[model samples]
Target: MPLVRIKSLPFDHEVPVPQVISALSQAISDAANIEQQHIMVTWEYLAQSHYSHHGQVAANQPINTHPLLIDLIAPNFNTEKQIASMLELIAHTIAEQVPIAKNNIFINFTPAYSDGVYDEGHIVEWDM
Candidate 1:
């Protein structure tokens, strides 16, 4: 299953969680063709003060975002590139609503293998 998770490091800003989720999921579903029911988008809140590490400006830093990273496991790994491309729409939608920089939103995709993956409680070949 492909899960979309959003973690925030806001800097002295108060954003509506419902707005973010609504915009993000709509954009993701439209771009990725994943039904709204199947698209699992979740987010966690973090204060600007909490984003600091060793006392640095890393928290809620918009300049450090990467707008491309996607992981789609086989037998659908081929969709990885397309999925990565769709992130921009998601980022842009969020940016329009909030102050999140398009560039600072980084996404990563990983294709998992036989490393503990099973089909219906058993190892079997599946095709759709």
Candidate 2:
């Protein structure tokens, strides 16, 4: 359930996605004290001028010249304080590319019951 998803801003500048991923993996692993194997991270780009969701600016957005969208998902649930901390860990991973405006980033943590999710199209673990 500890998954880190990172999506970069839609900029022509080729972000060292691999380097950034390593940094994120390290940060999240340290913060959660968990192995890197359980973590999942991804990066996607969105043009500032051409991207808008629900008539509103999307999360992990760029407010200026097409900022990058960086998202980190963990096995956390409920409350802004928790989300904020997780975002900080993730933001620290790519702090070089993102500013600490608090509004420039977004984070989510959903605790999925292992039973609710599947592996190889089978409910691997549903017993308590």
Candidate 3:
């Protein structure tokens, strides 16, 4: 499973949050060759007053100045190519949905050991 967390300023009224989430989840699943049901996505909106870049608050900067941060946590089994594809897919997916530039979207991939993940009341085993 890949758990994706996206943090950004609130999207415009024209952008539906649920649609973005669904698209991101589907992209990750396709990139990783995993079932869509195994992918988890969460979005957190940061208030413009609370977000900053180079000490300038988002409210004071031009629109889309603040970057969109994405955290992708997954098992440590994917190849480098897979990781690259996932990052590309994620950035493109968000850029298409939101007004942010593709360059402003930053995705951080964190690898977790199979034994470290807990689900369904027990630790996950990749080999199982």
Best by lDDT: 3
* CA-lDDT, candidates in order: 0.57, 0.57, 0.81
CA-RMSD of model 2:
4.8
lDDT of 3 by residue, 1-128 (tens): 88889987765545688998998888777766789878999998877578878787764223457788899888788888887888889888888887778888879999979889998789988862
TM-score of model 1 (CA atoms): 0.64
Candidate 3 ranges beyond 4 A from true positions: 12-14, 60-63
What is candidate 1's lDDT per residue for 14-107, written digit by digit as tens?
7786877777777777776766775556777565545654356454535445222222232344365775565556667766776666665666
After superposition, candidate 2 runs with Cα above 4 Å error: 47-49, 53-73, 76-84, 97-102, 119-128
TM-score of each: 0.64, 0.62, 0.89
Name the top TM-score candidate. Answer: 3
RMSD of each: 4.6, 4.8, 2.1
* Tens digits of per-residue lDDT for model 2, 1-128: 45666554454445577777777777767876767876777766654545564465544444442234554444324256866766676755566644434444555556556556554568745434
| Candidate 2 lDDT (Cα, 0 to 1) | 0.57
Q: How many residue pairs clash in each candidate?
A: 9, 10, 0
| Model 1 misplaced stretches (Cα beyond 4 Å) | 53-55, 58-76, 112-128
